[model samples]
Target chain A: MSTTAIPTNTKWWNGGRSPFNASYGKVMMWYFLMSDAFTFGAFLISYATLRFSLNDWVDANHVFNAFPFFGHQDLPLAFVSLMTFILIFSSVTMVLAVHEGHKMNRKGVENYMILTILGGIAFLSCQAWEWTHLLTGEHFALTKSGAIEMLNTTVSHNPWGHRISGEVLTNALRHTSPDVLRSMILEHNHSATLASLKDLNANELISKIDLNEVYVGRSGPAAFGSYFFGITGFHGFHVFSGVVINIVMLAKTRLGHFEQRGHYEMIEKAGLYWHFVDLVWVFVFLCFYLI
Target chain B: MSDNVMTAAELHMPHDTSAGTGRIWKIFRLLSVITIIELALGFGLARHWYGEPELHHTAILFVKGTMCILSLAKAFYIVSVFMHLGDEIRNLMMTIVVPLCLFIWFITAFLWDGNSWKNLKNTNAGSKPDQTEQVVPAVIEKGAKE
Candidate 1:
């Protein structure tokens, strides 16, 4: 009977030096994705923690709404459903590109990669528009509930929501209301016209309104807007950078660099990054749109 | 080779990453449709069409649990076949899925604990623990306060 000696060298390449011998770029990308997944998981988990901990947080619908042209109504989280489908579609295309890469099909890989990139750009643009809407104060309502009676009414506010633009506001107020009109308008103004009250931007004509009466965008405490802006803004930055990278990759593909390489590693790498974006949006959509 | 373009068939797929992504894709498609059905069922329950919020809540709990599991199945298909994580060592797959599971589990516990604590503080919402003081025990006499 002979005893076998244990081999000392085990790594595919000592510390993964030989990229080809090792898992190549794809496997390495998976490792990065794992760690990145953890980061996103932490953020999403933290969001869940914070959201659950809060006693008086804004309901998702009250916070997010459809586009300006989409009936201007407080739409449910349906738009996010569309966004999710788009991302999943992109991910599928990316997977197809990876499959093609293995077969050494450059043009086919390029076609799918282009489609995936387009999908990514569309998702990011949607996110950007969403963030801008939240930041610039659109499609949100001010709901008030009397603590003692549980009597709730949404005093339609938002200084920006006024159909009366600056020109219109100035025109409407051109003739100060008579004693009765002034009092009625003043009461309605104090009660209803909310965004006007919290005048962060002095540019708007309503900045002329009394400061104490207006609180920026109806929800209690400024933490509402702060968290909304902070998280979505951060995600927007990711999308922006992702777009820049995708654009470069797209241009490189158009120049036939991937054709020479006989592999779609560039496309695959970009796909991984695009998937990360999609994953982040899932969390964002769940938190910001759903419960 | 530079001039030779990749074929559409090759791009659609050439290698079998796992059992069959085609089959897997079809399964996922079925799963997604089922999920949509579950979602509607959940909504139906929520609307009290089946009667009683408690019953509805319990139904939703199972429904949502099913949805979550089905979603994981989708991920498994993608990772195992598409990403070939399944082809990796069994231990490696566990390395990914297990940790993710533990994370979700612990977070669920934390959320429940936090909710209970909030309800405790409020003296409203869900039921609270005993507020009455405990009576001093007549010593067991075994140790005499030792």
Candidate 2:
């Protein structure tokens, strides 16, 4: 391979021809990511719309919490928290891989690439756990936008979730006070049951009740789950694609192409994609789980 | 093929090396700290426990948005230094950043339209009960049941 092509003589100077180089690959990836971000953004915005439109049904805390371990009480999203950390850690490793790629250290880049792939898998597993936990409980009963009208139907086709026990939700419901909840909804000195609570004022309804609403929709355990599962699931799909891309890059790393080129833009491009995944998770955590 | 002696300008060996652990590491560490703080904010906000200092919706939104802006910074850093995106011709940087910034604003606008004060107004409108235009039969059922 003669390193003889001068900058002026290269096909890039000709302007109209396709070089089929790494620049095109990276640009295409960026374009694809930008479009995908828009899609995710649309879903999230729609969620916020439906959530606010909801009269009585938005309960961020109770809906998204994890099944607590060992203490006989269910946890509050500890699993998702772990998922977030894992993703960020993976991003860190990805940056390191790019760094090593620059140094033409094929072995180091390959190792870190494998590590990033494993981290992505770990995050996906945690998400799988989170999804199953949400599907089984609470979403069967639909609530009106103003938090009134509990319709009778579970959201999922399966009655039982894969990870969480129905008993946990049953216990939560058992512990919840429909009486106090009712009182919270009723105006001062007014007695209104949850049954007769239709056409209740939506804003005043949530404003009056201090306690958290139970799981989100009759469609699912919480409304957050809809956003949670949808947004996180989509992002997870991106992570999966990234892993596949990395596997290809890893194969290239083994073949000594990266060393020959003496630049790790391919790996760096993958980092951009990976970082985007981590970035989206941050938003999901803040919007769906935190607030 | 014309046999020609190509100039050394042809030898484009990129100065790729272990330029990894310096400033970029520092920036990544900063990002990690921000993320940790974000987690703390999340946990703090999750509980509605009394005396825990409840934050307003605007406040929470600002804090959360800050995390996103930090990511934009990280993206710039990665592209500029790692991908050499910043070293491009002037039109190129504008081509990337300007539209991206516009998209951010666009995302923010739609989010607000669907979820912000406008949404608040919608909820208020939908939730307002028609006491003046009462559900008389429902009241009858209530009175009768009583």
TM-score of each: 0.61, 0.64
Segments of candidate 2 deviating more than 4 angstroms: A1-22, A55-57, A67-77, A137-224, A260-263, B1-18, B48-90, B115-146
TM-score attained by chain A of model 1: 0.62
DockQ per candidate, 2 decimals: 0.09, 0.16
Off by over 4 Å in 1: A1-24, A138-229, B1-74, B89-92, B98-102, B124-146
Tens-digit lDDT track of model 1 for A190-216: 553444334333233333544343222
**Root mean square deviation (Cα) for candidate 1:** 13.7
Q: Is the docking of candidate 1 incorrect, acceptable, medium or high quality?
A: incorrect
Lowest summed-lDDT stretch of 10 residues in model 2 chain B? B137-146
What would the per-residue lDDT of candidate 1 be over residues B89-130, giving only the tens digit for each residue? 443456556766766676787777766654454443434333
